[model samples]
Target: MTQRNSSFPLTRRAALAVLTSALAFGAAPRVALSSSPLDVVATTGMIADAAMRIGGTRANVRALMGPGVDPHSYRQTRSDIVAMTRADLVLWHGLYLEAQMEQFLADLGRKREVVAVADALPEDLLLSHADYAGRHDPHVWMVPTLWAQVLEGIPDLLAAQRPEAAEDFAANWAAHKTELAELDSYGSDVLSRVPEGQRVLLTAHDAFGYFGRAYGFEVIGIQGISTESEAGLNRIGELVDLLVERGIRAVFVESSVSDRNIRALVEGAGARGHEVGIGGELFSDAMGVPGTYEGTYLGMIDHNVTVIAGALGADVDPRGRLGKLATGS
Candidate 1:
C-alpha cells in the first residue's frame, strides 16, 4: 500500500464527504479478520485505554496520541500510518475531534475496519458545537455516564472480531461500566458541594461542555470548542470582566492547551482589582502521564472532579478517589 502524505487534512469537510460517499456505496474498506491476537490502533490514549480494558490480553492496542497531545491539531506521522494500516481494527473519536487527520483517517477507513467510537452515541445525547453548525462536541469522555454509554458496544465489537475471547470481553466491559458509574456519582456529588452561584468552571478551551451539563457548573472557555479556533483580545477582555464582576476565584488551564491565554485572564483580572488564581490544570484533550492513575480514563476524570471541587471550596477527600494524585497536578 502506498502511504499518503503525513500532513494535516485542513480541508476536512470535503474529505469527509468522499469517505461518506464510499460507505454509502458499500465500497468502504474492511479489515480481514485473523485468529491471532487482534491488533488495534487507536488515535487517542483514551480510546486505546478502553480497547485494552475490553480486549484484555486477547488484543494488542496502540495509541497514536499520548498525554498532553491535542487531537484537534494532531497530524498523522509516517509511523502512525504504518501502525494504522497494519492493524486489525482502528478506533478514533469522531465528531471532528481529529480535525487535522480526518481526511487521512477517512481514506484509511476505505480499506480497513475503522470506527469512531463516540459515534455510537445517539444524536439527542450529543451537544451541538456552539460555533460550528452541524458538528457535535467530541469531548464526550468528560462525562463518565455519557462516555460509558458510548463504550458499551466496544467490547461487543471486539468480541465479534475474536469470538473465542467473547466471554472475557463481556466480563471486562461489565466491570468497566460499573467503575464508570461510580466515578460519575463521585463527580456529581463532589462538584455539587460548591455553591450554585459560584459553580463556574472557566478553562482555556471549551472542551467541558459535557462536563458542565453533566454536573451543575457553568462552563466558560477562553477559546471555542476546538482549540483550532483562535481567541481574540476582545474575548479575553470580556472573560476577565466576567471574572472580576462575578468574583470568580479560580480559573483553570488545560494540560494539552497552552496556558498563555489563561495567564492573560489572570493578569487581566488583576489589573481590574480582582485577584484570580489558576485553580488547576485540567485534562481536557489528553490524560495524565502513563503508568499512573491520572493516565487512565477513570483517574483522569477523578483528578478533574477532585481538582475542580477542591479549588471551588468543596470538601473532598484529600487523598482523592484512587489516592494517586501527583502533588499540585
Candidate 2:
C-alpha cells in the first residue's frame, strides 16, 4: 500500500461515531435547503453519479476528480479545497483508493460531514489484496452487486442532514439497486459467452479484480491495484510471454491510466510472434464525459462488458443490453 503524505487519521472508524451520533440524534449540520441546493463534493465520478441519483433535486454535486483523473495519485488543488470546504456534504471512495488524498479527507471529516461510501461495505465480503496483509481492494464498483452495497451508505449519510428527503433517497437507491442487479446479470450472461479458456482480461492496472471475479474471467494487470505502483520491465516481459503462450488476442487500456505499458505488451508479444491487438479503452478509475451515456455507473460497466465480450469473441449485442451504448462500442 502507498503511504499517506500527511499526518492525520486515515480510516472511516475514526469518524464513524461522529456520523452515527448525528444520525441518531438528528443534530448533524444540515445542508442549507432553504435558498440554495445542497452543495456536494465527491472524490470521483462514480460517487458523483451516486450522489446525483440519490440526492435528486435536493443537491448539487461536484466531482473533485474528473474523467481520466487517476484517484490513486490525485492531489487536491486549491480549487478542490475551496469546493470541499464550501460544500454541504463530501463523499469519497474510502479503502485507500484515493491514496494521496486520504489524510486530507480524514482531516476534513473532523470539521464537516464527510462519508466514505465504500467503507460501509462488510469486511467479510471484500477482497483482500495479495500484497497488503489486511487492506481491501478499493475498486468495489467493478462488481455491480458489490457496488450496490456501497449505495446503502450514501443515502444514510445524505439523510443525516436532509431528513426530509430521506424517503426519496431510499426509493432512488432501491431502484438503482434493481438496475445494478440486472447489470450484474447482464455482465455474467454476456461474459460467459467467451470460452472459459479465452476469458482473460488484461489491463493497464489491477482495477478489475472484482469484475473478473464476478464474471468468471482471469484478470491480469501490468501494474498493481494502485496506478501509483510501477509496472516493471520484468512484469511486462512475463505478460508478453503469457499473451504469446495463451494466444490472447486483446489487451485493454484504461482511460485514467496511461496506455504506454499496454502498447509495450502488444509490441513485445509481436516480437515473440504473437499478434495481439489493443482491445479497447476501458473506463476503470473514471467514467466517460459528464453528459454521455458512458458517464453513468451503469453505462461505464455496460461499455466495459460490451467491449470485453466483443473482443474476446462473445456474441453480445453491439448496442448494450439496455440499448444505450454509444455507436462504435
Query: How far in Å is the alpha carbon of 161 misplaced in model 1?
Result: 1.5
- The TM-score, computed over Cα atoms with residue i paired to residue i, of candidate 1 is 0.88
Give the per-residue lDDT digits (tens) of candidate 2, residues 1-329: 24553423555566777878877887655523352457899999999998898888878999988889999999999999999998899999999899899999999999888888987898888887786556788899998889988877888877777777889889988888889999999998999899878899999999988988788889988998888779899999999999999989999999999999999999999998889998898999999998999999999999999899988998888788789998663
Candidate lDDT scores, in order, read 0.89, 0.88
Best by lDDT: 1
Model 1 score (lDDT)? 0.89
**Tens digits of lDDT, candidate 1, 72-173:** 999999999999999989999999999999999899999999999988999999998658678998889999889988888888889878987899999999
Which residue pairs show backbone clashes in model 1?
A: 29-110, 29-111
Note the clash tally of each candidate.
2, 0
